[model samples]
Target: MKVMNCPLNGPRNISEFAWGGEVKPMPDPAGVGDKEWAAWLFLEANEAGVVREWWCHVPTSYWFIAERNNITDEIIKTYPATEVFNTRVEFAAKAGAGEKK
Candidate 1:
């Protein structure tokens, strides 16, 4: 069984965590075309070397980042999401846009 180090909870069973997805930069939606938006939503590098991704501790609902090797499935390091995703970008709803109640 694989073990993953949780930034907040320490080391734990891999089953206790969820793979959130690869960590990537969010594109500026207003300046990009539909194709770019679609790619961002659907595509992943899926590279064979070390890749950075997001993982969540199921019990605590805590999310963090992990750097692991895709080929060997070895976790290199883990850190809080804030360390990498420090900038928060807020997208304002445009006029006439449907808002969720």
Candidate 2:
């Protein structure tokens, strides 16, 4: 079973989460007009390889997390939903990886 840790909600089953698609190019609300906003909200780029994504924690109503390179079943950098602003992605420090909880 795959597991993920939401910064806001803490560790939880990955199945409980929902993929909101690649998290990139957050449209500028002040700069872009309504038309652009509409597209940004409704449309998705859907790029491949090393992409940042927004994952929703349904069971826990926490901030969305921005994961990187989310292809296949496993996604990297499952961080707090609020820490989305962190430009640098720190891969999960799992056991054997010298990461102590």
Best of the candidates, TM-score? 1
Error of 1 at 76 (Å): 0.4
Lowest summed lDDT over 10 consecutive residues: which window, candidate 2? 86-95
* Residue range 1-101, candidate 2, lDDT tens digits: 77787777677887888877666666654467789878888887767666667788888656575656646645677676455575644444435775565
Which pairs clash in the backbone of model 2?
7-80, 23-52
Task: Please report, in order, the local distance difference test score of every candidate based on alpha carbons.
Answer: 0.92, 0.69
Off by over 4 Å in 1: 99-101
> Candidate 2: where are CA atoms >4 Å away?
86-101
Each model's RMSD to truth, in Å? 2.2, 15.3
Query: Per-residue lDDT for 1-101 in model 1, tens only?
Result: 88999999999999999998899988996787889988988899898899999899999999999999989999999999999877878887777789665
